[model samples]
Target: MFRTVTRVELSELDMPRADLAEALKCCLKKVRKGHYIIKSNCPNSHVDTIRHLLREPGITFPTFRGDIRDDAEKLRMSIATRRDSLLPEDAFSHMSAALLHGLDPVEVGTERVEVTRPAYSRAYSDLLFYARDLAEDDVDHTLGYPVTTLDRTLADIALDHPLEVSVPLISEGLRERHINRESLLPRLAPGRRGRKRALLALELASELHESGAEAYCAVKFHRHGITGMTPQVTAYSSTGAFIGRNDFRHEKALVVVEVHGVGKYYMHPDGPNAAARQNHQRNMNLVNAGFKVFNLTFGDLFRPKIFEQIKWAITQALEHENH
Candidate 1:
């Protein structure tokens, strides 16, 4: 969202008049002197006089040096005339707005801007505006400028980005555990007419399990008639701090299961390796204190080998529980 100048105030310091003019003049040269301090193309000399006129309407800078006030009215007036330009997208600037809005998934580079145009549009050949066709629902507004909502942003990313790129972003949200799922739902265009694949993509995106991995494991678990196992369940510490809610929890046994994804081995900037390592140390401490830990990777989660392994582990834990 964009912010507008909601209010203004004036203050005075015991600084000398020449030094004050020099400082204010620098502010004027850098940005507009009004309500919003936007970048300006004004000279230093004229800026000081404008600052003086702001303090007192009839005051001239060379003649009126006593307790001069900055001009609030003229500053506000300069920006008020350019109200239409005060959009959030304006802050993003050029192709940056497109990536920020989710019209496209762009590489997060320092200076390279990325944008997308309509499928039929002519290519501009500008290195900055790397264009692509927009899905109808992807185009929307934030504070009256074009941008995509969070859901659409993620969906677009899923469709366009590789697992190495996408997983890190998703893992960051999950590891921090502060993803705003409710607000993100609106941006998902669920049906065929709109962003048809987005809802499914979102569900897939949240899955920590590799594709088809959990399904394979679940089938074997069900076939064995594992009475105590629950899939897609929540987990908590003894303190009930809700640490890493899991894929499965055997309530009777107090054991948590996680179905790890493929990227677990990859070293991304926000890779699961670091998070998993930290979790492993904590989980070891829990096990040392007589808690149960059950983890399965993409290799294990999808394999028949994992079912036998888990069956063994559960049997051993159940024996300990009886003791």
Candidate 2:
């Protein structure tokens, strides 16, 4: 979710660099280089002046605030800009709506904005418009722009994208409590295209998964027939002392699988060295408790060879437990 900064509309003016800077100096506050913020209370005359200046070249007033460096924020700005330029009847849908509703971007690219309008389907420039009738419950204006509700957006994603792309998003929505399966399943009825894939994704969706990567990892485990694993399992010693909460655990096999991101250590609040030390200590504790730890990276999870290694690890751990 985006932090609500000062609500300001951004205008990408077409004028000489120096002239544009001078023109906006009086009515707008220059927030970033080449970007200005038009305050909500700006005089109507100043607004008229901006409108007149852009009579020849059209202007899109995208309302966004914060660091433009963030990719998610950039995508939000893109969605806003596209929405501002579109007809009032059009509403953001599919992946674009999912982003607005705070679902992980996942496999969806930010290059094109997805929209829906009655009796209209076309790809123009950076907008992919769908032709579909939206029910009243499907549309929302909570963000000050027309966007599909969370359930509707998930349904659209399930219909349009594969499980690899859609599962993470659906899982996220469930985890966030933004939408429920009971609400979303009806949208993917019997006659709908991609219903099977959507149903499978919904079946796999779980609120217990912490991140999109973990959710995707669950899908991978399901596909590879890696069974008997539970998510977010807490590990304990034979004496009933807590060791740590694991990403995944198989009790019978006495195995714990941890999915590590590239910046897991570096992005910690404490220094990376401290984070690494803590992780090392945790691993030692888990090992001392007779739990075989299998640490998997994002890259490792994507490659099939790593799963073979994991299978071997699981088998070895199971044999050890039996012995």
Best by lDDT: 2
User: Residues 143-245, candidate 1, lDDT per residue (tens digit)?
Assistant: 3445444444454444444432333343334334345556455545455233443343343334343233444344446555554666566555566655555
State in Å the error of residue 261, model 2: 3.2
* CA deviation > 4 Å runs, candidate 2: 1-14, 17-77, 262-269, 316-323
| Colliding pairs, model 2 | none
Candidate with the greatest TM-score versus the true structure: 2
Q: Any idea what lDDT model 1 has? A: 0.44
List TM-score per model, in order.
0.32, 0.73
Each prediction's whole-model lDDT (CA): 0.44, 0.72
Which residue pairs in candidate 1 have backbone atoms (N, alpha carbon, C) closer than 3 angstroms, thus clashing?
A: 34-75, 34-76, 54-71, 55-69
